[model samples]
Target: MTWRARLLALDGLTPQLGDADRLVWTTLADAPDGAELVFLGLDDGRPCFAAIPAAGDAAPRLANPQLWGLMARLPAADLALYGGARSLIDWHARHRFCAQCGGDTRLAKGGWQRDCGACGAQHFPRTDPVTIMLVEYRGRLLLGRGLGWGEGRYSALAGFVEPGESLEEAVAREVLEETGVTVPSATVRYIASQPWPFPSQLMIGCHVRASNDAITLDTTELADARWFSREDVATALAGKGPFTAPPQQAIAHHLLHWWLNQPATA
Candidate 1:
């Protein structure tokens, strides 16, 4: 039995959906000649690939829709596949030129790496690491609203991991820097992680026990920072309350959900 390869074609950042509002990955025979392809691996003995359409043109039979809108609509496996494709495609788009010798680079290693022509440099796709923590002090959890997130939108403290810091260190430093709350190293515990491909980031979720309750908000980083009781968090999670937590797609929501259900730790 001959297995035909499939291609997930993206026009710009939008994916092609079929009449039933499902992803319509093109067969190798239907895929455009110049489309950039990345081998995504085998699915039921049939090879699957992802492609970024060379021209930003949508096929007449397929509907081009933004990736964010399809997150909740697609199945879990499809969402994961789409997220991985987006990250790789975005990396390739940005790294077409080599930094070492200002030369052209071509995709290699099934789109996992880039090889430069003029220089011997090889570049790989990068996934930025970020620390997102739910900070707890006594009975309250620390939530903050970033600038321009609008009123009533609050989430856990998060920041990118700096060059030489551990994930725990990043969590502690982010909480302190954004909300002026100190979370001891011993109190920081890893909870769960999520791949957030808003370009490419791996969000490391942690639970942090704060040493102090008083908050001195960093105006540049946050618009407001405050402690919310367990009741408030529960209400927010239940879709009630003045403040809204991050959506279900974010790691923040899972961290908040986990923290709210745990037995009191004294």
Candidate 2:
């Protein structure tokens, strides 16, 4: 489960799609109401991934909330287009009024931007930055049970980066705030990133050295917090432990898997 860089769904498609811009534009224009669209990459133009709505006699399988965790199983084309389309549409949905003057905004720039009618302001999609960190102390990494996550599920500590904070600072502060575990500023390392559109989040992954073993769960954010050794996590990932891995597609899984498999580097 180490990060071997198996062609991630979006990264692999960025290079081969020729004339991507025109294709994406045309696709967007004709996209059905329920079709999922994701922004892939620019071939010769801005590229996009598109998923068609359920055809006649075809049930709306993708629309089921229970199937949310199966996104990784979705075709790369479908995922990319849906990811992009959902992000764009959500942006349009939320930015209906100009923030500066409360004026109405109109979609522009091929559904990528919005122009304010009264304030002359231009609005764009927002990707709220969230810090997701693996806190290591001694030989164990910290994981938390989120109130929102289902039973028996645990994920790395995460929180939205506050105004006036750097990514490293956010890592240290979020770990401390969520688990009462102080993280050293110098030992933080960036691992990976992913666009998480459960609503519109850009997850910044990192590994941090925890200064202490004691955990005081920030009850409002986490139901519990604990440390697990590499062996423990390995079992979880293998589905033999009392707990389980985060969803395979999440960067949290990749980050944890990276740490669990990495050999000691001098």
| Candidate of highest TM-score | 1
lDDT (tens digit, per residue) of candidate 2 on 43-107: 44435443322321122322444445445555566555555655555556566789999998776
What's the CA error at residue 201 for candidate 1, in Å? 0.9
- Estimate the lDDT of model 1: 0.81
Supply every candidate's count of residue pairs whose N, Cα or C atoms clash at under 3 angstroms.
Answer: 0, 11
Q: List the residue pairs that clash in candidate 1.
A: none
What residue runs in model 1 are displaced by over 4 Å at the alpha carbon?
A: 19-21, 29-33, 53-66
lDDT of each: 0.81, 0.69
Worst lDDT run of 10 residues, candidate 2, spans: 4-13
**lDDT (tens digit, per residue) of candidate 1 on 202-227:** 98989888999989988999999988
For lDDT, the strongest prediction is 1
RMSD after CA superposition, every candidate: 4.5, 8.9
